[model samples]
Target: MDLSRPRGSLWREFFLVASLLACGIRQASGQIFITQILGIKGYSTILAVDNVPEDVQEYSWYRGANDSAGNMIISYKLPSTQQPGPMYTGRERVNREGDLVIRPTALNDTGNYTVRVVASNETHRATGWLEVVELGSNPSLSVNATSLVENMDSVAANCHTNATNITWYVNYGPISGSDRMRISPDGKTLVILRIRRSERTLQCAIESFPDIFQRSEVISLTVSYGPDYVLLRSNPYAFNGIMKAEIGSQVEMECVAYSLPALKYHWIHNGSLLNISDATMNLSSLAWEQMGSYRCIVENPVTQLTFYEDIRIQAPRILSVVHREFSILEPTVVLLIVWIVAAGVYLCGVLIHALINRYSNRTNRAT
Candidate 1:
């Protein structure tokens, strides 16, 4: 080999390597940077690289570690389709902007994500962290009993969940500790002391993290207390203790008791129990015999409290007169005939006495 030729070739090779190294440094300075992402379970998320070069020839995605040490999730070549790994086979795709799109992500998909981009003269690498979490299934709320008697029975609302942090809510707000409302240490159970007749709503919740939480369905709580404030009302009207109705008229009476879980109704008339079981009693036709004192007895089964209200059924005066019309007519007719017969006998006795006296005097003169 000529000595000059060897020298020139060596110088050219050295320059080429230096130029390539400079080009690599420039590429590294302009490499893409991926941002950290948080993904929710069963929901899709994206891992995107910023400032990707237009001349990239090949793209590779890795999970859990760096490009050389991590498991390959997918790879894409210029002018060709992408190839995905078994775990993300159909669930992942590379968009036109070279961003990774995961459809319907799972909890297992969370890990360190790395992407390598091979350009014409340089290689670029970026890494990011992905955290996956779940709000989880809606928690379940249960109670020892749905209904409790006031001051005599208590109830516990239990929230069931697998989460680490649990919370309790009453009527859409956070529950505060009180003499009547007691919360357990784990916040899974809430106890109601001296439950009253007021209705309440309870709910449970769990937080996967701050600002991310799931809540359970609402539960209705009922406390049965009293049969107080009992009222008996009639359709037409009731004044004092009486409810008036005409014969052949329809009448409706209702018994109302302010109590939880409702009160059982027992209607009584003239110390006899009625056959109806509802809170309302309907009479199709009013009769004179049906007019009497009507009583409504309302009782609470939970508290064993009882209430009584009475209303007197008064028939119209016209109805009473019409009911005895035939009996009055028959007695009046008999009394009138007896008076006429007595008057005629008195007149006949007076006339006969006068005639006998006159005949005795005439007989004495003739002798």
Candidate 2:
């Protein structure tokens, strides 16, 4: 064998490696397409690799311990399309067609996955990361009794949700193993049994899968009682009209109080509470006896309030009439004044006639 021929072949191999490196750099600078993704919990999301180079014929996925940085891990190839390699369990494969899908994923089942595509006897790899998030459902709360009956012995409250394997709580107090709290066999409803008056407060909460799902609005209750009712009245005030009675006539000035518990009624005369046990209080109807302020007060000890009305009484004017027998009964001083006027008129006429006659006689004598 010639030493020069071996050297020449070695140089050619070096040149080939350099050229491949340049080609790989140019290819990497070009745009690659990622059309789909998976590892989603609820909605249908698929991992799709689009516009893959025509030269690539086989593809596989792999996983590994976290990279130097704990932030990421890796996935790689497999021996066959049906059988993945050691670290590539639960991975997907892509053939001439470029597509991958993961169904019903778990949160921990997430990491960086590396795709190795083989074409033209060369290998090309790309890495992508997956994040598996757990999505949960909402909850509903209901009181066992539609209408809350106050002062009742005990009651039941229940909470329900659509998700499975639920945990319940009330005001942050866990319901698990609680004597008054119980979960339905199906995990749909949570019942709080034998609720006490002190425990009348209720807060229904739920946890779905990994997180606290929701909390219900608070409900409060209190004891009940009967109606507290009372009636009110005031005293009578100063009067505008006159009151009349005969000399020996009896007059009764009265005040009336009306209320239940039959109010503590008092008769007030000039601001003083008169001790009258009865509903009606009486006073003398005479001007001096009944003239001052009068009031009827009605009060309730439970209510602690007093009502008053002012009243005044006045005596009627009295006039005397004297009568005489015979002729028009000399209408008294009025009749006497009339008679004196008539007598004066008659005397004036007589005097006038006498003066006129004397004047006439003198005229006759003079003539």
Candidate 3:
């Protein structure tokens, strides 16, 4: 063997190895940085590293403060070999670019993550923080009673959810407790002590974070109450509890009751049912027989309460007595005129016969 040839071959191999080492050191000096990530539970997330060395050949992932004593999640070398811990059940994987992806993440995945990338001769490292939170589903709203009577019935509203921070709203504004309003300890249930007609809309919402909230379906409240401030009016005239109408004239009377859920009307005339079942009563071609005390009974269907008003209807005052007296005097006046004429004629005939008899007796005595 020639000694010079062996020395040249050894020098050539040493120079090639040193050149490769210098190239790896240059690539390792590149920046290794990652960004903090936020994730929701039951979703997918990626722990991405930025500025990764192009000549990197190995990657290692850890789940703690640093790689010294942290739990190893995944490790990969060069092109194929991969090592995964119990945490990487088929849902987690490391891509060729040194990025870690987790499918269907959970709350336990929140922590500091460290990624170490190795080139042929040097190592590079990066750390990132992951924060996982749970945003629960939307809540549902319910009520004990949809309709309530004012000052008589009460209503309660409940917001059903698993969220911790809950709030109540009425007509798009915050609600506070008072003598007529009450709130539960957990702020889930709201009760109206005396339900009113003004309270119409109610809503419930969950505050997941500051300025981040979700609202449930809106609820419309219905309140029912009285037939108060009842009124009875007629078309022509209504004065001194009387509705005046002339004979053969038409009359219309209306009964008005202020109430919720509407009202049913019943009319009475002279203590007899009028068979009319509506708020308006019509009398076409009125007669003297129709004159009587008319009463309107208004009843609330929801509360089963009743209100009443009374009015007296009379025929025209001038025509009523005139017609009565004219009918009575008509027959009497004709009979009296015939009797007077007959008596006058009989008296005149008797006086003429007496004068004749007296004149004849005087003439016979003078002869």
Candidate 4:
């Protein structure tokens, strides 16, 4: 330890010691002061404190409040014993390196963040701000009935909001072919050609821009009178089942016939054609002898269809009491004449009694 060495040597050694002490103090100060940094809310980011001293104890972070009126209200606290505001809470190890990192940043993570460093002798702080944003949600779509009709040419329609475009398809059945129908350029309607009544079933589809195949609705149609022939047979030429009536009983029998074309009706009884001057042939009153098999013949010239109904009447049931009462009228006349003669005799007796009384009163007066 040559205390008295050359002056230059002493000076150079002293300067080197002083420089080393200063560097040590500077490092200590840097470690005491912690810094924090933040970025947008949705972005992944980091917290930086590059000027940390060599002996940093830890860090404290502060989350901002959600209120609009408040200015970065504290939400959490770190180093519970310190009990800073509830929001001023974050903890991490900060060493001389002064480098810090946070991964997988969240939207809530956006706010004012601070770093608190504690060295053996002092404490320091640094802060940074962060921003956040949210992405838009997926859109929705809807459609009318899923199918379409050709000859009716009615189309399936769709509705949606915030949509860019749409498309349609024929999904099922023999109408699976798409080329038969054409969609309008504006995606409004579909046109089909040479559509027969049988080809009424069709399927339609729709979509929106940016969305793949969203959903679908259906439609149905009926076509009128196609060439496909329908052969209608006559209603089996049914008779009115054979109606039976008693003579003298008023009978009204209707013979009805039906065909695509109109029909002419003729009435016949007992093998003789009934001259029907009117639609209803009136016999005025029917007699027992006139009872026989009655028929109505219906013929349609256009349809070449013929029909008939048969009706029969049984002979009248005559009462014997009515016949006996009619036969007694002659005897009733004879009894009536006898009662008249008895009344004339009683009238002559009354006249004789009156004349005798008158004669007796006159003779008594004269004597």
Candidate maximizing lDDT: 3
TM-score of 4: 0.22
The estimated TM-scores of all candidates read 0.55, 0.26, 0.52, 0.22
Candidate 3 per-residue C-alpha lDDT over 1-367 given as tens digits, one digit per residue, 9 for 90 to 100: 1011122355334433453354342324466755435655766666666577678898888887677633778888878778886445676778776777777778988988888888877898877677788877878999998888888888899999988688888888888888788988788888988788888888989876443567899999888888876898897778978777888889999998899888888999999998899999888988888888999999998988998999998875664444344345788988999999999999999999999999999999999
Q: Each candidate: what lDDT? A: 0.76, 0.48, 0.78, 0.45
The candidate with the higher lDDT, 1 or 2, is 1
Superposed Cα deviation of residue 226, candidate 3 (Å): 1.4
Query: Candidate 4 residues 230-258, lDDT tens each?
Result: 22111112234443445455555555443
CA lDDT of 219 in candidate 2?
55
Superposed model 1: Cα runs more than 4 Å off:
1-32, 37-40, 43-103, 107-125, 129-144, 150-152, 157-164, 171-173, 185-189, 196-203, 214-222, 225-228, 258-262, 317-367
Better of 1 and 3 by lDDT: 3
TM-score rank order: 1, 3, 2, 4
User: What is the C-alpha lDDT profile of model 1 across 1-367, one tens digit per residue?
Assistant: 0111122355334433453454342334666855435666766666666677889888888886588633778888877779876445577777655667777778888887889888898998887767777655788999898767788888899889877587788768887678889988777889988876664778888876434567889988776778768888897799997888887899899998788767888989999998878999988998777888999999888788888999998876653434444445877888988888888887888889989989999999999
TM-score winner between 1 and 2, please give it.
1
How close to the true structure is residue 146 of candidate 3, measured as C-alpha lDDT?
83
Error of 2 at 18 (Å): 35
Model 3 off-target regions past 4 Å?
A: 1-134, 319-367
